[model samples]
Target: MVKRFGRTSFTLSIAFAAVLSAAGAAVALPQLSNGWPYAPTPQHTDRTYTLAAVGDIACEPDTTENAGNPAQLKCGSASLGGMPAEFATARQADAMHPDLVALLGDEQYEVGKLNDFEQSFEQAWGGLKMMERPSPGNHEYYAYTKHGDNEAAQNGAGYFGYFNGHDQNGTPYPQGQAGNDTSDEQGWYSYDIGNWHVISLNAECRSAAFGNDCSTTGNGVLARETQWLAQDLHADHAACTVAYWHQPTFSATTSTADAPDPAAPGAGSPEGTAAQAWWKLLYNAHASLVLNGHEHVYARFRPMDPNGHFDPKNGIPQITVGTGGEDLDTVATSGGSYTNPNLVTAQDQAFGVMNLQLKPNGYTWDYRPVQAGPGFGSTALSYHDSGSGTCRG
Candidate 1:
């Protein structure tokens, strides 16, 4: 006899039936033709993987700004009361034991010098270095002036050296990981993780040391990167794809406010606008998602086409998780109201990491904020968001 049970009671009924069958009882189970009891075919389980991502991390060790003030937006601010905010987030990522860690960008503060990374970022996230797939941010190329004017700009030297290992002949920069910025390579690569094809692009092509032109028509780093991306997508055979970089084409923060204003759309960064070509390529390839940092907040956008129109069946969702211990920024406001119709949800008050559970044909994301220590008196401890989506394939 075939029996149907309510969702809540189905598990119990299955257990009872299995027990009766194991005891060799004369229970009338679902049967096929002839005299044999029917057996259900086992379902195939898809291999799944996990990735932890975040950026805008690691305060400069020498920064004295807000030395012990956890509430202030400065390098020395602490999280969980006593721990450095960056370290707290690192610990959170470590606990997840993810298969991969995507360092969105700006892994180190100031100019991302090798020493700064060694002194600050390495102290916290070093354990995950081997598994990290990194992309360079503007800070890695050109940032605050510690040496003199633009002289302090390591031009991706520090970033590549730290990730790809320093050169043996005393050359400051290395040529692996994201590749040297001084060359046409410009650091764009793709790899497969489980059933997903992951691409990491460098969006800081506008840096003076690289190629100042990010325009689609310019024959610069951006152009070369886009050409490489087109080829990469053409060669990809994965059912699902995700691309990540430093800047975002769709920002969660507006110009007026630090957070997204419901009254208006986000004013995306110029670098992001330059990446529209990338969006077009990925969209044509039916990419599933885009991950980004640099906005210093966590924001999730509804799936949208390259033109920024909602396209549930064909659009790609972009998740910006820049809350990697750097000070968070408020969403931009228009007329004192939050707008940005494309923005689904955003949080700027917390330092956290985003955990992505990647499946064969779909994925789920969970944004977990660092727990505040006793008497921390912060709202970050309460912020959380999670959702699942199917692959466009």
Candidate 2:
């Protein structure tokens, strides 16, 4: 694998299963020989499929919500500042023909309005919608509170509406889209792809005000989801397992991307206890990998145990791939941001996609950046990271 480093400075730029559902179905994705601006010819592997993953995508300039009220606005151009990166990564994934696309979260920008998904995200990623297995992000939940746009989201109404088979405007959900028909509302589910049990989680607990704890005994929305997660893990016996969501339990950056109010006193605290609770369960179960977004950058930690200690022999690896198509954030060289103290690799430059080549007994991961261009704008497109690991779940 090629390694690119030393140019730390750069401008920021950049699915699912049914509730307790089994995977016997196949999704037919659009075929594209070569279309992306900087498309990379994916390496061909016989019987070794790939799962493409990235998050924090799609930017829309429109401010009107379904209620005809103005919505919360973020800094994004008509191109969303990350649209090119989004399309480029989508094109690359399409060309690679990944068996599944795991969207960590924040598929739509600035409050995740339903129209935004249609006008911006769907337009670029429609080709892979059917193959997308997604988790909800803070944007999806922001509408519930004033933090989003002061527009009533009815607790992520637009998000659940769209993924549960309808647009917020009541349009039908695209056919063959990921997520179980019954549990799309919660945005959590599990399915198997070639002996790997993949769980898509809803980690916007604070945004949803679910609870501080992710235990089944807790009486909150997060508890319910965690309970479901436990049950899902108990029921499935896959040798390799991966769970993904928004908001990482461990962060390499010091900034808070999902903060409810960064200006609030103590608002920027580390903010991963809830996720840590989920991690406890996963650790006990020997989960192989945990993927997340919401950091606006890419960071991969070494396999870590429940206590956030390195344990490559028996711990799960957590990867934050928040660079799907949004402005980037810097990795922490000090303690100002939430410093995890052990980041195996990280980058704040160039938009890219992580390809997880899933094999029967192990998997290989490659985070390939888009080719250098005005789109990347000297954001270190040469940054590349790859590794292979055996299944521990």
Candidate 3:
């Protein structure tokens, strides 16, 4: 069922109240059925629909250093503790009335505590919570990794608590209700929107186990998720398909240098190699598109095959839209700075959202930068990029 919102606007005051409600105060969240992770009911007739996608959002105000900072809870300022980019993107997405919202990952910054998501993320995007189809990010599971042992933590309990909380019977999913074991391990699943088949996967392998590569690791959640992807793709007959996860298989920026054994937990480093295993599955299935978050910028690469070779006729295009609300990262300026030769468009300064108009045989994308507005920083109004492509399948 579609949810109704009585209030038509979001302000700092409302965000503060949301924080209090998250803390033990009585406040009812929007009603979501047991089938919280859902897709639009498939239609046989040819049609089109739009969805907003982005990630790396919501900053936590109550850091260890600022735990008792009263002013931080005010939610008045966009920069100090408040997430200006999150509010801007959420508000813009709400106005667009897209069929759904695809939150790539990093929904909450700096450890993804349940309270942080409620206060910061829900405060801005709560009105559309049920419309969210999300994948877990490094923030959600990094605490479970060796690199993030000391900082804020949750072991992903909070992330799952918010998304996979209750079923229609009011039974909590964490108790093994409905056999939904994917709740904690690797929240991977596939669904259909129009003629499109979409898959969301968990790529933060370090979160599940220490010293594990997300792409090539042969056991545990990564292995199971890879097996599941193969089965899901073989079963689906959609003409157009897209797969999304936290990290990108190909990043155009120099930020991702390969880590030397549990290196620092930073955004840009040589990473995403583990995702190559997943890429091969999608490629063999003739997938149409791939989406990711983590680079903290907006980048669109040319159509390429599973091995990162240009193959516009049968390869998949990947877009990194990690500029939701968190700080941005610079794209490599010099040629040969990155591995992927198909780097088409990349920008790091503006905060924005990527809109995809999915058709039966292809899709069109529009990256709309959120201009200066309440809770948003000053930025010129313009689209970073816009184009359409036919489905390779």
Candidate 4:
């Protein structure tokens, strides 16, 4: 049994109140099955869709270097009492029967070598690969190990090969579904689901494998991506749109100045900062939402503009669902108070997958923590956060 909440009505009431107050009219709202009043917008359609999203999943494969480390050994370890958290989340996501699975990135841990993805992530998430729309994370483009010390991995070659399909002749990099990362082609694309348009972007523009720069001024990889995005958005006519990648421009977790262990890589970090350009494009286009990972925690922020100020009417809300497994991180806090004011809610103690129900004119999100069996230890798997939001017209 999945948990449901009345927060959807609370959110809708706030939004509708502002609209109704401006119009100065007393219009009766139609009630939906979820108890929220429905107002049909331009994006209205009879059909609805569900998406399961998360990232930073799958542990490092058990190798000579990863042998004794419990973090790397827990991918599918039955000794941990029950199914590993990643596997549990996978099962939870499978149960939803989502129309699509958006993998925010870092699907494979450590260096994301093809062998590791095969040994670990494949066992846990391969079942959903057919419907998955994946993006690359920092781990996928790392030429060195996860510690940033050794150089034993291919830069995104493994990632490209896995999702894009490998060649029978045994090539280091295969170009197919994910596009050619080693060349000028890049790996950003968009598609439609019902009335919504979804985009998957590559955030590893600063990686040496790309152009080592995310500036949109020159003919760099990210610059081209920006150009493509502008064109993509300009051509899109969807009433609601969403763009997703790994890092976020407005992170929910801050540094030690605000919290203990920083779950995110700081909203001021280069990648996060560079992402503002993308946000500007999306915001200007009236995008509905932005999904991201790389934080190792679950956080949802109030709708805000590209500059990070609250903009409930036209701004885009960002949801960080990085809690797909791989040891969770602590949310930033000072004396038990959250650091980021825009953060609506955050949980760091449990691994979970976010189920997004995309309606015609709006959407509802549910963060379902993975339920652990008897052997899964004392993880707080009962934590939940859910709400609904209307799309910008």
- Top candidate on TM-score is 4
- Candidate 2, residues 1-393, lDDT tens digits: the string is 111111111111111132221122222222211101121223222256678899887765454443343332332443234567678777877776777788988888667766677777776777777567778787776553343345544345556556555755574442223342222225566656665777787766554445433443434656556655655665567777888988887766654454432222122433365666678778877888899888878898888876677786888888889877756666766444434555778887666778998887789999977633224466587788999888776
Question: What is the alpha-carbon lDDT of model 4 when measured against the actual structure?
Answer: 0.71
Off by over 4 Å in 1: 1-45, 63-83, 145-151, 168-173, 180-182, 256-268, 334-337, 371-376
Tens digits of lDDT, candidate 1, 295-325:
8888998888766777888888989998887
Model 1 per-residue lDDT at 88 = 89
Better of 3 and 4 by lDDT: 4
Error of 2 at 265 (Å): 20
Q: Rank the candidates by lDDT, best first.
A: 4, 1, 3, 2
Cα lDDT tens digits for candidate 3, 1-393:
234322111110111111111112333222212222332343643878777899887776554553544443324444432466678888888877777678898888667766677777887777777667788788877752332234545546557666667565533365221113343245666657777887777777775432355544344556545655665666667788888888887766653344222112222433376677677778878998999998777899888776677886887888999878766666765445443446787777677889998888889999978843334345545546999988766
lDDT for position 175 in model 1 = 44
After superposing candidate 4, which stretches have Cα over 4 Å from the reference?
1-45, 64-83, 144-153, 172-175, 180-182, 256-268, 371-379
How far does residue 233 in candidate 1 sit from its true spot (Å)?
0.5
The per-residue C-alpha lDDT of model 3 at residue 165 equals: 70
**Superposition TM-score, candidate 3 onto the true structure:** 0.77
* Among all candidates shown, the one with the greatest lDDT: 4
Global lDDT of model 3: 0.65
- After superposing all C-alphas onto the true structure, candidate 3 shows an RMSD in angstroms of 11.4
Give the Cα lDDT of each candidate: 0.69, 0.63, 0.65, 0.71
Cα RMSD to the true fold for all candidates: 16.5, 11.1, 11.4, 11.2
Whole-model lDDT, model 1: 0.69
Q: For candidate 4, lDDT tens digit of each residue in 1-393?
A: 222211111101111111111113333222211111233223225578888899988877766655644542445454322137678888888888887788998888767878788888888788887667788898888654343345454568778878876777645443444544545546676766767877888888767766688785455767656665666666667778888999877776676664343333235467777788788888888999999998878999988887778888888999999888776666777677677777889987778899999888889999978854323445577778999988774
